[model samples]
Target chain A: MQDSEDYLRKKAFFDSLLTIYGRKPVLEALQDESIPAYKLHLAQSNRDDSVVRAIRDAADKRNIEINLCDRKALSRISRNAKQDQGVALDLALPHYGTADSFLNSLPASFELLALDGITNPQNLGMIIRSACAGGIDGILLPQKGCAQVDPLVIKSSVGTVFKTRILRCKTLHDTLARFREAGTEVIGLSSHAKRTLSDIGGSGCRIFVLGNETHGVSDAVSRISDSSVRIPMQNQVESLNVAVTAALIAFRKQL
Target chain B: MQDSEDYLRKKAFFDSLLTIYGRKPVLEALQDESIPAYKLHLAQSNRDDSVVRAIRDAADKRNIEINLCDRKALSRISRNAKQDQGVALDLALPHYGTADSFLNSLPASFELLALDGITNPQNLGMIIRSACAGGIDGILLPQKGCAQVDPLVIKSSVGTVFKTRILRCKTLHDTLARFREAGTEVIGLSSHAKRTLSDIGGSGCRIFVLGNETHGVSDAVSRISDSSVRIPMQNQVESLNVAVTAALIAFRKQL
Candidate 1:
């Protein structure tokens, strides 16, 4: 009973430190001084010897606690049961203002990426990482029909989740309309678009709407788009992966 | 002893089937009707139940043998292993002509994509898929450094690996030189390039070189490039995924 209570208190303490898992992300997170870590969880045995050492060194530098656990326990904590390499970290995610406030805080030339219905956490995580790297002002994801910024999303983001501003909007359509009213040009990426991405010139402020993996942008989003454009494909294969497609659009629009 | 012999025969048959895994390449072989399949593996428990059934029914119509396996076994055979959704066809990959002959066979406005030391099989597979969709005439990969058209590559390609002409050259530099000698403009996509991808004006056959993930194009390959261009990205991000970058280049060139 004492051990169980100790475990519970420890869990709560670790949770408060900021949870980061996966070798690449945790390693990246350690580079930032503002991000504090409470403890490190190293799977009792790990195949990657170098990664294990690196994690230990980082934890040591931060003066953080280290806990060694079984693969099953590590898996349960990391939420990535397939391949954990036996490493996880408790690092705090930086706080950001609300969606409206975050947007208002951006400079005039800033652009934002709005995800309509991207449900894959990996994809969403990657998009967030890419958005942060691309220097977008913030990302606005719909409250419904999208992957939440969960642990899996955080891991795939390579620690960019800590730096990027992600806002969850109640309604994507309404939010997009507000952007339009606020003088932001909204562009929807679609294969069916008659206009090529090159034809639609770049502007100071814009919102690129990325849709679901299979069906693409909803009709409601499409109806409000200032323009719809496509990344011209060879017409032989179906389409590029949603994440890849989103990166192309987001990157190209900034170009 | 009899069971052992049967197992050996099955192993030999599977080895033979493994030879032809790319979708379009395998389709061509199937059209030839010379390649024989002992059995087709299908994940009968996929969410896309109808699609799997349709594929099975089509195979049945072709008088091909069918084998129902669990998703795990099916994943073992697939390259990317993303929810194969109960579908994998045991077909032979067709042989194509040399790069010169393949190039000669193309139309005037054909665009070709070349990869410099892109060893990731998943990226290669997806690039082939996207190339086929983008209507690229052929893909030029370095014989020594690039990923071969393996089963995993085919699976990631969604079968488009077979449909495209894959030219494996001894050296990308030499192949690129030959293309330049043949009056085909060679363009390199690099983050350092001052010219935007949109700035390159061309109406003839074009080849775009995509470098590896970490290192852009090798110095040798970049040296011979007639033009080097960059996809404008927001300053926050360092680079786009190689596959996504390739797709954007393909689409931009197509436009």
Candidate 2:
């Protein structure tokens, strides 16, 4: 019983940690007083430049733990040797949490933007930005098929990834099924859907599932969707980018 | 006067050619009979693969010329040595033309999507896909300060770049000025605009100008715009992705 409890505590600690790499991003995170940083990592081989100096100064001022390791160790920690620029930072973002916790914290009537099989980091980041800007209650991002919250995603999101409420799950299909069981309407965007997005109104707890860029919503996920709606294309043109579709869904009410 | 006339003739001839590289894209072009082929280029170092054989077969069936050159020559033709994969094709797209020609061909009460300082190739491609799918009459793409119609853009557009009507301009500011002169309603999107996009209806020839990714609409472009509109954003989120914004504008009628 004690071992199981310790394992759960360790898992929770790792789950709460979000590691972001790159010199400029590390410096920016250090400068931001609101960001709760756990540790600052640097490579011993890093050249002493003004940016590096600023990063060190900021981290010292913030009183964050600093670890100076070899290049290989830094790479292992950052997980992106090429673009990490020999620096990485671990931040415990308050807005990031699991789907269960998010569901427990939600109001009676809320909306969420869920992603399935979205592999492009830039697209994932842009979708997060749209969801945040449009005031979607939470973003349901699967830990499996969807893109990870990497540096590219952070860059494309323009730092909104840190600010947005992200609900993580192991698989989108399973989590969507759970939401449906909880009396939430799971809506998928499809080209062949009979009704348009504007047709969807008077929602209770709702989850909008955006699919892959090419193949679209997986068949298993579609089966569980309460209903489907399309954005209504014209001129015989097929579809919009997945990110654009997410934006349309995010700002559907405003429109 | 004769020398100037020759120069103009040559310029028009070169302007009509759209070159796309990479083996798969070239092979796809060869397969599509609707795409007018000008020439096919291949590198001598290329292995005899099934795709290359299919490309040659398709080109031969279509009576297109094939030039097998050195690696250097192939790279020169493709202009992308790293990703060209030893193949290139020149296509005479019917949908591509200059701003002046596009203006001459415009119908009354039409909508055009104009891009200003959109540097991301992926964003430009997604914008083209949205514009084409949403049935926007024309896309006013300033040749300067915008991502070119490169392989990346073509990939992101998912072949809609060939189908969409593209209006190439030397600069967006100059083209918007000309559109204003022609009594067209030039509208710019901004976060600070007093009006929302839905407020502007019953347009007789409208052009919606989207600005740079970081900066909203440029000052010069804003000066020429008859009016400006904003997309309502919530949750203190500053803006949406440029491509997402384009999709919103493109599909606003349906919304």
Model 1 interface CAPRI class? acceptable
Off by over 4 Å in 2: A1-15, A41-52, A65-87, B1-15, B38-52, B65-88
- Candidate 2 per-residue C-alpha lDDT over B80-148 given as tens digits, one digit per residue, 9 for 90 to 100: 899899999988888887899877766778899899889999889889998888778889988889998
Q: Pick the candidate with the highest lDDT.
A: 2
Interface RMSD, prediction 1: 3.2
Full-model lDDT for every candidate: 0.71, 0.87
DockQ of each: 0.29, 0.59
* Positional deviation of residue A179's Cα in model 2 after best superposition, in angstroms: 1.4
lDDT of 1 by residue, B70-107 (tens): 87887776643653444556654343324554556556
Q: What's candidate 2's DockQ score?
A: 0.59
Name the TM-score of candidate 2. Answer: 0.86
Distance (Å) between predicted and true CA of B111, model 2? 1.1
Which candidate tops TM-score? 2
Which lDDT tens digits does candidate 2 get at residues A112-131? Answer: 98888999998898888888
